[model samples]
Target: MATLRIGIIMHGVTGRMGMNQHLIRSIVEIRKQGGVTLANGDRLLPDPILVGRNAERIAALARQYGIERWSVDLDKALANPDDTVFFDAATTQARPALLKRAVQAGKHIYCEKPVATNLAEALDLYRAARAAGVKHGVVQDKLWLPGLRKLQLLNDAGFFGQVLSVRGEFGYWVFEGDLQPTQRPSWNYRSEDGGGIILDMLCHWRYVLDNVFGKVRSVSCLGATHIPQRWDEQGKPYRATADDAAYATFELENGVIVQLNSSWCVRVRRDDLVTFQVDGTHGSAVAGLTDCWTQSRVNTPKPVWNPDVRQTHDFFDDWVKVPDTTVYDNAFKVQWELFLRHVAGEGEFRWNLLEGAKGVQLVELGLQSWKERRWLDVPELTGREGA
Candidate 1:
């Protein structure tokens, strides 16, 4: 079997997500599985060079993964013609410039989402990638998630007949770094560092809503900085300027209403860290990160409301668990495989940079909706809106 070697320059992967998801789980696992098989029966293998500003951290990450190449010089790495793909998981503000440079070097582009901190910058990256005439993609990994995939399958099979609405609950209480060490990075709670749940998570919800249910038509959002103070990496306390929580309502073009509550401050009493409950006339399904439970019209339990009396029904027991029918891989890894195949001239990749820009556009509207306390519309983008 002939294998096509594809060189990739992976930047900022020394960080948490870049290390765990993209590098270790995705690329490393891809190597172990003998690369992604193309439609024409050829296998595509990634030879990635880890790049970052911190020499020690980057080198250690590379060594831990048994990767040979590691570099602190991004420019030098980008200039290498052998490395045809450029992937970045860097800071939001630093992403546009880095992507612009890489595309100019004639490399195919792939990176983590939010693409930029704003819509204009996000559009600019799309424009640059298009102008460079190289293939481009973004990390919309949630689209391939096992739970979401199961939901998609149900949707495809018309299980949720006449879909009505959706509810998404996502978050967990993050320790304020004093009583217990914070699980999230300190920068996550700082607005100055390109942080905030709205900016970070609205991007995720945008894609998930648009792809799974329907295109988001508009948004109404309320944001809050629940805990005003949090300790940083060095155990130093600082005022948190960014929002930790957001209660958002979305209207889909298809008339499906969606309510999503995202917060780092709230405790998770739900099924998973993130769960989507899709309700329909004929049936309803609640999907977590891995498993999905469904209550069909035939099996759904009816309840009576009486405030004075104790509840008689067990709501949790009403739904039937959807059995796993297929083996599921890491979501990020799945997206990476599709991107690799797309680069190898296999098929069309719908999750392009422009799709990523749409995610940023939603963030802008969501933040504006919060500030104004009113619903704001999401306009369709064609990547030619005078960026």
Candidate 2:
């Protein structure tokens, strides 16, 4: 079997998403599994060079993971022909510039979501990548989640005869970093860092909608800063400049409606940090980060309309648990394998940069809708030209 020693120039490997999702879960796990086997019985191994501005952090990560290569210089790393891929999980503001540089260096591109903070920048990045004729992708990991996969299966099987609506509850209370340090970065609450709930989760929601319910045609949103301030990692006070919560309603091309509530300040009382409930004419299903269950109308007995009588039957007891037919890995790891396969030309990669641009468009429209307090129409992604 042939071995593909793929050199990966991974930027922002020190950050939360970079470390946990890209480095540890995806790359390291793949290495531990004796590399990914190609369809033709070949094997592909990732030779990652960790790139970052911080020397100490880079060295620490390299030692921690037994990674041989580490570099503080991105430009020098990009010049290496061995590094055929450029992966970024940098701050939203840094993504466009880094990706542009990667394209000019003739590297395949992969990056974290909200590809850019705005629609124009996102579109330009897509356009640039298209012109470069490079294989590019944005991490759309939620689609590969086990619970969501079950939902997709049910949807595909037509269990939901006519889709009616989708309701999503996403979030958990992040620490204020005052007495205790926050779980997320302080920049997430700062606008200057390209941090906002709408910009972040709307990207996930866009793909979830397109893949499961239908294509989103328009949206109306209300964004808010529920918490006015937070403390930084150094225990310094910082003013919250970004919206922490976003309430958005989407109208799909198929006429199905979706309501999503995303927030960082909200308290969690559900099964997981993220939960999606989908209701249709024939059945209803609710999926969380770890579990998915469905209720069919056949099991739901008809009830008489009575104002004086007490309800007898238990509605919640009727839901059946979705069977786990296949072994599922962590969300990011699943996507990593898929991307690796696609890059090797074993299969087609559908989640390209244009789909990422559409996500940015949804967030842009969301912000506009919030500002004007009106519904906004989302434009179609009719290839590179329309985007």
Q: In candidate 1, residue 1 scores what lDDT?
A: 72
Could you say which candidate leads in TM-score?
A: 1
Candidate 1 per-residue lDDT over residues 164-183, each given as its tens digit: 99999999999999998999
lDDT of each: 0.93, 0.90
Residue pairs in candidate 1 whose N, alpha carbon or C atoms collide under 3 angstroms: none
Candidate 2 local lDDT, 1-387, one digit each (tens): 888888889999899999998999999999888778998898889889999999999999999998999999999999999889999998999899999999999999999998998888888898888898989999999988988999999999999889999999999999898868899998999999888888999999999999878999999999999999899988999999999999999999999989999999889998689999999999999999778999898866676789888888776678899989999898998777777887788787888898998899899899999999999998787556535
| Backbone clash total, candidate 2 | 0
CA shift of 46, model 1, Å: 0.7
lDDT of 2 at 32: 83
> Once model 2 is optimally superposed onto the true structure by TM-score, how far is the C-alpha of residue 67 displaced, in angstroms?
0.9
